[model samples]
Target: MEEVIENPDRIEIEVTDVTNVIKPFKFTKDTSKSSLTILNQSIENIDIHEIWNNTTLHICADGGANRLYEYGGDKRSEFIPDFIVGDLDSITDEVKDYYKKQGTKIIPQLSQYASDFMKSMSLILLYFNGVEIVDVDEYDGLSKLMNQLNDKHLVNINSYILNGLGGRFDQSIHSINQIHILNQQYPTLKNVFINEQDIVFMIPKGRNLIGYNSISDFYKGNKFPVIGLLPFSPCIISSWGLKWDVRNWKSSMNGKVSSSNGIVSTNGVIIECDEDLVVNIER
Candidate 1:
C-alpha cells in the first residue's frame, strides 16, 4: 500500500486507532475495546489502575500473577484476574492461592513448546469464544481448541501485554517472534507490547494510519511522541506526516533504518511498506 489517493497502482490504506493507550478506560470514538495480559516480570511503573479498569478481559501468565499480586498492593482485592494460564512453574504458592480463591480460573498448560505468553493469547481466544477454560486439556489445551476454529470466525482482540519485552535476551526475542507470528497466523489479533517507555507493535504490509483524531486530544504533553520503524526483514518503505517521512526508501537491519523519529502531524501519520515492520512508539 502506498497513498491515500485512489490509484490502481496503490493498495488501500487501513486505519488503526491507538487512542486506547491514553484513554483506555474512557469511551472514545464510540467504542471501548482492549484486553490486558501481564507477563512474568517487573511492572513497577505501569498504570495498573487505568489498564485494569479499562480492559474487557484480563489474564496473568504464570509468574505474572505474582507481579500483579504485588503491584496492586491494598487494591489487589479490587483487580482480580479473569484467568491465570501457564505451565504452573513460576507462580508462587501464595499468589496462586490468592487469585484462585478470588474466583480466577487457574489453567495449567504444561507445554514447553509454547511459551506462557502464547498460552495466554490462546486462552484469551478460547475465553472470548465461550470455551470452558477448566474443561480443556492441560498439555496443549489452548492450542488444541484454538486450531479447531477458523481464523475468519475468531474474535478480533486488542491485546496489551505488560512486561512482555525487555526481559532476558531469549524471552525478549521470543516475544518479538510471537508478535510477527500473530500477524501471519492471526491477523485479527492486534497485540501491543508495553513496558515503562515503549508501546511496541507490528506494522503490517501496505498503508497504516497510526493515531486517532489529533495528537493533542490524546496527549497534552509538550514533546512529540518518539517512534521507530524497525525492519526485521529487509523491505521498501514510504511515509507521510512524520518529522522525517521517507519515500521509496529501503529499510533493513543491515542497511538504513528509521529510529528516533518523532510524530509531527496533529491528525495522524501514514506509513506504507512492502513488508511487515516492528514499530516502537514512546508512550
Candidate 2:
C-alpha cells in the first residue's frame, strides 16, 4: 500500500485567494508607540524600521531568529530582540551564536510538547511584565511562570506586531489561535499578525471601527486596500456595518464564510458583531 501526501502548494494558493477579498480601512503611521515585532517565515512587505522604532521590545520565537538574522543586517542594533526563546530545535547554531554575542538572552526550553511559537509568546509575556526568566525544570513549568507573573501583578502587555504567517498552514493556524487565546486571556494585549501582503487580527465581540486616515497608510498610493471579516472559529456570528452587511448571519466552518467581502465606504468602516471574529487587511 502506498501513502498519499497532500500538496501544500494547492492549499496555500486557495487560502491566499480566499483571504484577499475584504477591503481594508487604513491608518497613518504614528512612529512613536511601542510594538513587539516577531520575524517569522514571511516578512517581505513590512517596514522593519518603522515597526522597530515604534515598538518598545523585540522577541524571536525559536527559529524566528534565523529570519531576523537574515532580514536584519547592521540594522541589527535597531531591531535586536530583547529575548529569543523556543524548544531549541529548528534554530541554527550560527544564528544562536550571533544573537548571543549581541547580548540577547537565549532561553533553551527542551520541551517537545510546546511549539516554538508558544514559547516565544511566553517570553513576550515575561518581558512585558518586567519579570525575570527564572530557570524551570520542565516545559510544564510554563504554566507556573504565567501564574507567577499574574500573581505579582506584572503582566503589562499593550500591543504586539507579529511577522510571518501565510507560509506553513499549521503554523499559520497556530498564530491565529494565539490571537484568540491572547485576547481571551489578556484583553489588554492587542495582536496584529503581519504577512508579506496583509495584516491579520481579531475584532472583539462588540463594535469596532476599522478606521484609517488615508488609503495610502497601507498601500503607499494604491487603490483601496482589501479587507475581510472572517469567521474562522467554530462559533456562528452575526455582523453589521459592511458594504454587503448581514443581519444575524450565521457563520461557521459548516456555514457561510465571509472571505471575499469588500469595504465600499470611504470615511472608514464599522463592524458590530455578536461574537469575536477574525479580520484581515491587505498590505
Best candidate (score: lDDT): 1
TM per candidate: 0.87, 0.78
- Record all residue pairs in model 2 with backbone atoms less than 3 Å apart, i.e. clashing: 22-226, 22-227, 22-228, 23-226, 23-227, 24-226, 26-212, 35-55
Model 1 stretches with alpha carbons more than 4 Å out: 1-33, 217-221
The residue-by-residue lDDT of candidate 2 on 111-165, one tens digit each, is 8776777766666676567666667644555545777666655443445555646
Q: Per-residue alpha-carbon lDDT of model 1 for 1-283, expressed as tens digits? A: 3222212211223446322222221312323446789999999787777667767888999999999899889988988998899998999999999898999999999989999999998877777766666687889888888765574376666788887887689888889988899888877678877778867888788877675565655455686777799997999987766666677888899998889877677656678788998887776
lDDT of 2: 0.62
Q: After superposition, how far is residue 201 of candidate 2 from its true place, in Å?
A: 0.5
Q: After superposition, how far is residue 137 of candidate 1 from its true place, in Å?
A: 1.3
